[model samples]
Target chain A: MREGTGLPAVDLGTTEMLEPGTALLIPTETSGYQEDIGLFRAETGSYYALDDECPHEVASLSEGWIEGEEIECPLHSSRFCLPDGRVLCLPAVRDARTHRIEVREDRVLLYPGTAATRT
Target chain B: MSIESILVIGGGLAGFTVAQNLRARGYAGALSIIDPAGIPYDRPPLSKAYLLGQKDTAGIALAPAEWYAEHRVELIRGTVRKLDTEYLGVELADGRRVHADRLVLATGGSPRPLPIPGGDLETVLALRNKEDADVLREKTTPGMRLVIVGAGLIGAEVASSARTLGAEVTLIDPVDPPLVPAVGQALARRLHAMHLDAGITLVHGTPVDISKTTHGHSLILDDGRSIDCDEVLVGIGIVPNTALAQAAGLETENGMLVDENQRTSNPLIYAVGDMARTRNPDGSLERRGEHWEYAMNTGATAAAAILEQELPVHGASWFWSDRHGTHVEGVGDMNGVGATVLRLAGEDPIAAFHLAEDGRMLGAASIDGGLTIRAARRIIDRGIIVPPESLADPGIALKKLAR
Candidate 1:
């Protein structure tokens, strides 16, 4: 229901190609990869991308430990999921965002809202 | 019945703030608030400015009766006995039920009682809310012997406030060096000296053996020294009101377990204030914060989360007290910190800063105008490291703590 849910996609030509099991964090509008928290290979061999920066404090999820789909921030250790971006911890009441990615031929491009606005 | 209405229970500081914010933020659905205690009132001033007659109870209320009606906020009067999540409602004590789409548990907490004998019979008093202050105020007579248990922030402040009202006060606690629970033992001792200088008798490393009397009460010490007192005041600590959460099958630790958004086990429910102990980022359970600023900030944070809105990052934890006309404020925990910088603002003010090993502010203590403590609070939250020279120079107002 927020503004700019359906925006035109730009052609992200040739870049480093990641396998279906692995994810790459490319810069998105207003959002960043935050840290190098590689990616999660789902049961269906799908990759989910997320911002390693916690929505709560200055804690980085890349430095923190990961469990299943959830990555905990090392600073405050607030847990956020890579799939739907749901928060599962205290002191962090906001949810981190998951970028919609389009893997064409070999390049990976991140789209802000490939689906609905979860902001 | 399907609930499209939110019922905020307990019209204390937390409850009113939640309702006030929801309306301000454009929540147009049915909003209700519950309070058996009548209009929303403030308890912070009751212990300090109110007792000193600096401010009256009327000045402290968050909401008057008319404000609720103006906002179309349904203010209910009665005790909310049980909460049923499946039914999407709360059951009143009188067998009535209030329907709600969401629930906010803001019951607050009760004061910790003296662990001594005869504590049950009111030989001593514990203060957490406004009612406790009213009872203690009535009993405080001129030149009455008052043996206060616990020399922590509450105990010391109460002692200081009671002393101003003409009571011979003796503060009893087990802190060999006071303020040990907050700042380390060494720093607590330094502040303990301040209490002693204020003419308060500190019975450190010992507790009072309270006994009831025909007239009033008598505290028998371990050394066989009995101090006859008209009354006793306990400032040990507090316990959160978490029974409602536990009864509703919500997870609870020292208080109700809440996520960063202050959400309980159920997503439809949220808890805040003293009764809700949220886990820190380190996976440690942190509860029992009694500061007014912390309460207001945390309460606001929880309210925002419930609306699924982005909350401004939580600032550092803070505790403030006014003792014997002296203002004492602390930011962050100083026990794990080191290298306290002592500075004096002119000849009238004093400031002390506790720095973490990494040079970030761990905590700050100040006297006189409370400007430095306010500034230091912002600095600690942002993890700003002030230069040692800046800290040492009394010319530098702690306003530099705000990054």
Candidate 2:
């Protein structure tokens, strides 16, 4: 509920409305998703990670929003999985590197192995 | 010890530019930037392209990692809680304290929140930070109704983005044509056409009184008509984040009062961007300046202040908005513009300008004027006054002022 602009970060851990069994695929700051860096808040604590860059074309995955573990590219409807980096839709076939995460005190700390997530 | 290390508080355009220009100006020093827990990102697009899904945060990356390392700027990830002027340091929310020889409080402004009825939870949203945009984005369904409570630049940009996202947008404003506070009524009226043509419901001359309804809330207009809405967006104004500087005993008004050099009451600390209620040639202090370029230019001015270098005289303010496929620009302060002039590439595609009664031109807004905008900006920024005839003849360059 912050006035967060650009892909601002929303920690799923911060809200109670996020129910279990459903997953939230959030964008990390490493990807530079501007406003709410998509927060993946799974009530079950099960989450998925993917490159915010859409493998198809140049559309940023951060622009493309998340539905379940599948994130829809905002430009084209290129869908990809948060876990295991698989493309479920067309125009995007490359798998994005899964960002390593450690839930530190309910806050997700992203470990960029190469620290090369563009944004 | 000489001020060699700089800690810039706030990673918006100003903060980033201060760091960027420091490198560009050949000043090498230990640099650190503290923002609220996100990679440094550009914000102008949040109200437009980002909102329209045209771009994401990555698209507007100001500095990549290589740039940061090459420039030697450490990116501190959090909000600044307290600034110890005596210690020449800042305390971040994460409990990490950093010290610098000089501190630049670029802690821009926050969105002005409404304190009126129906302003409680489940009904309202503000577009300031990265999270707020996502909140609105998540809530906006294909047919979700959005009532935009203001018709200013940010509000209008959000309106355009919402409409593009397939949401039904209703912009309610008490002012006629909107943007009168920034751009005068004449230019505001012309821009109004662009909004209406983009499928937005424009309610003018009517103040909306928000009240709780069975479903979310309702904005009851002064005309006695009520519109049911899924959510309310108030972009009416902004509140400067002057508390940080104020807490440290720096002069503060509606914004942190600063001199033309961007030096605040304490010369040891400098303030830039909107947070600095900078003095004008007219002897008045500007509480706010909402342009991206102004932030960049002002940052450079503050850097000059830090270096004790001669600074450039203030130029005409320039700003742009890309909403609903239209790119509108204003050169010079639109606040003083009075007389109106409409230009056209052809008989159909048009743009407009405004000037005061004394023929002192004030503002300009163009729609797809292309490079013509480049020419117009030069004319306005350099104070080149063009005659009415040259405007009609597109062949002449906008710089021919004396003739």
Q: DockQ for all models, in order?
A: 0.01, 0.02
TM-score of each: 0.72, 0.72
- Each candidate: chain B TM-score: 0.90, 0.90
Candidate 2 residue-wise lDDT at B358: 65
i-RMSD per candidate, Å: 13.5, 13.4
After aligning candidate 1 to the native by TM-score, how far in Å is the CA of B125 from where it should be? 1.5
Q: Which window of ten consecutive residues has the lowest lDDT sum in model 1 chain B?
A: B343-352
The CA lDDT at B399 in model 2 is: 31
Classify candidate 1 by CAPRI docking class: incorrect
Candidate 1 local lDDT, B1-403, one digit each (tens): 4436888888877777788777766777898888887787767667765665665666556655687788989889999889898997899999999988898888888776656567666546887767778788888777887888888887887888888888788888775776755644444665667767777777854554677788788877767777777888877778788888899899998888887787888988988777877866677886556666556666788767767778957667766566765556666766663777767555432666788778988887665533566567668877777886797687665554453
Q: Which residue pairs of candidate 1 clash? A: A76-B281, A92-B260, A93-B260, A93-B261
Off-target runs (Cα >4 Å) in candidate 1 are: A1-119, B1-3, B180-191, B280-283, B344-349, B400-403
